[model samples]
Target: MSEEFTYATSEGPNGWTIWQVIGRIDVSTADEAYASGEEIVKGNEKIAIDLSTLEYISSAGLRVILRLNKLAKKSGHKLTVCGAYGMVKSVLKDSGMDVLLAAKESLDELS
Candidate 1:
């Protein structure tokens, strides 16, 4: 079965663009989500991702986030993720990416 994922972007305080991701992010939708993030990171200097609505994420999805985080750093932009909870946050913490990416408590922390 195919799952539906929604991705939207909005302006945050202090020039950061917040990308709100909803639904499950798995192999089926990881590429799309990653592309969306890449486009924003390419055009904006500050990017924040909100995962509050994200219900589930697979390793593929995590890879996409890691890639975007690396790209953001390489391009001299900042990438922050917030609102991760339960399994989503557990995966990140277990993989040690939580520290590597320097995830903030919220987008406001980035400011």
Candidate 2:
């Protein structure tokens, strides 16, 4: 069975909305991730996707990140990602998404 994918949101310092993505984000879960991310983008000006609990991410998952970036930009909002480690971090780096996502070491960097 696939690992259940899930995400949560919280308020961060400096008016940033924190979205914490958890579990595997493969083809099966990418669509949901994108939809939910879009909703969050619509509601907030500053957004951060915290990958601290994320275990795996596929190319489809990367597409979601790119889509969110576009949506945030089009809506005149700020978006960043942080706390990626292990294989999740490697995948983002290898795909050169780390730069596009503006990956940060932690949430405090946003403040």
Candidate 3:
């Protein structure tokens, strides 16, 4: 068995894509994360992953973020990480994903 997690996608202010992630994100759940995010980004120009509620993230989770970043860039969209705190923020910065996700301290900055 594997750990469980949950996520949700919604529209943010200014027509941005918002993905709210919760629980642990590891190898087993990376696919789900990717799929959900992929769909949320459809026909959207700005994407933001709300990680304030997320507890943990492994390399696999990082990969999911990277993939989203690539897709957004290829489509000429912007991807930002909104409210990434504690370890989640550290992981993004440590892996240098902050450059790709452009992790923002506030949701307002994400727009």
- Measured by TM-score, the strongest candidate is 2
lDDT for each of the candidates?
Answer: 0.87, 0.91, 0.84
How large an RMSD does model 2 have? 1.3
Candidate 2, TM-score vs. the true structure? 0.95
Clashes of 1: 0
Could you say which candidate leads in lDDT? 2
TM-score of 1: 0.92
Clashes in model 2: which pairs? Answer: none
Give one clash count per candidate, in the order shown.
0, 0, 0
For residues 1-111, could you state the per-residue lDDT of candidate 3 as single tens digits? Answer: 226779877888887888888887889888988888888766678888898889899999999888888898888888888898898889888988887667788777754
The alpha-carbon lDDT assigned to residue 49 of candidate 1 equals: 89
> Native-vs-model 2 lDDT?
0.91
**Model 1, runs deviating above 4 Å:** none
Residue-pair clashes, model 3: 0
Query: Could you tell me the TM-score of candidate 3?
Result: 0.89
lDDT of 3 at 53: 86
